[model samples]
Target: MHDEPLPPGQDGQESPGADQARSGTSLTDDLVALLEDGKTYLEAEAAYQKSRAGFVADKGKWGIVHGLAAFALVHIALIGLVVGVVIALSRFLTIWGATAAVTGVLLLGGYLFARSAIRHFKEAGASFGDDSP
Candidate 1:
């Protein structure tokens, strides 16, 4: 036979089945790749947000501690001032000498109360963190 019809491939006629198969494979691979990329992006973003939130929470904790320290320091300074004034005024006004001592005691008590309040705030803050709105 001089030229019997060559098969589809030999004659260069593209088969529809082959084209459909390749198209299906390509679509599947694209979907898989897109899913992986999305997963990676979400993981990285979650890590960054967590670390950043932790840092911000730590700053809040430090602020609580600083407030406690400041409260104590101010009371200490006030007590010292009152004591010094009382002693100095003793020469001029003997009747008011005890007033300074009472005031000093009250200020010291206030310092202790402030410390308690600060501790409460700190513990509460620690228990309730940035996770909440």
Candidate 2:
């Protein structure tokens, strides 16, 4: 058979392995480089996670502030509603009678809401297989 030169790589460039062999990098050198790269990657990942947690914490603080503000405003609005109901009822009944009626109704509604909350809490606990009181 006629002797022929080996064909060049697809891009007509030396492969990466050829370059590494020419550079005389030993297996130990390659392993050390891999370890360094892994350490750098892990450090970068930790920094990224810390920054993400800080961002979430900042946003969560604002969310809690806004939620509390909304809750306060709603409670204020409910107070106004209670006062308005008391005033309207006073036109047909004595002021004391109107106040008593409103108080009783509010207490009843609160009791019902508390009962529902207790039931839901028990259901949630049961779902987790927690039977303790």
Candidate 3:
């Protein structure tokens, strides 16, 4: 019998991992890398969500800016509806400001929970393994 490294991508068996390995890729490493990427993404998403609360809560220049932006955008869309337009704008500004504030708070909360999200994803990654390999 002769034992030599298969030329580049010539796998003796048709196993999925074997095929990937023959192509100079490691399924195990790929899986780990994917999990790591997911963990990072989730962490970032969660962070964005959690911090949103604080950002919104701070009723400072930002709050007015959001309120004004919403006011302009929402009212501009209703320019044709003359009746109750003023009242609608008033109500919408209040509600939209509140909504933005709440969203900011939620973002902040998500940011805080990002760590847990990463940890959960990491644990999941650690769970995948084959003793035969």
Candidate 4:
């Protein structure tokens, strides 16, 4: 049924040497493709991290505003409590006496709290091998 001879390299089946040469070329192409893929993955990761940091920074501004508002509210509440206590004590003692008593008690309590906080700070620093007095 065959009427003409086929070309040397155009036969139906590839030669063994030709297959080896093609495989060598394919290996190099695969290496280059792998490197390109890795570069793209790294660029994507960097972009994602940058986006996450921007999101946190944007939210951080509101976080600071809310935190300051809460802090101010707490101080206002404490002042109101102090005023209420002074008014209640005025019924038992003179106005000036009640004010002096409350002031002394508050000062003593603040001093004790300050001492306790200092002790705790020292203990925490000691755990990190700090020897500073």
> Number of the top candidate by lDDT?
2
lDDT per residue, candidate 1, 29-84, as tens digits?
A: 87999999999999999999999999999999999999999999999998898777
Cα lDDT tens digits for candidate 3, 1-133 = 9998655444544555666655686868889999999999999999998898677767677778998999998887755453344345556567566556555766788887998899999988888865576
Stretches of candidate 3 off by over 4 Å are 1-23, 60-133
Write down the worst ten-residue block by lDDT for model 4.
5-14
**RMSD to the native, candidate 2?**
5.9
User: Residue 77's C-alpha lDDT in candidate 4?
Assistant: 100
Candidate 3 — worst ten consecutive residues by lDDT sum? 80-89
Candidate 4 stretches greater than 4 Å from native: 1-25, 130-133
Candidate 4 Cα lDDT to native: 0.89
Error of 4 at 33 (Å): 0.9
Which candidate has the highest TM-score of all?
2
**lDDT against the true structure, each candidate:** 0.83, 0.93, 0.73, 0.89
- Model 3 lDDT at residue 92: 58
**Looking at candidate 4, what is the lDDT of residue 53?**
97
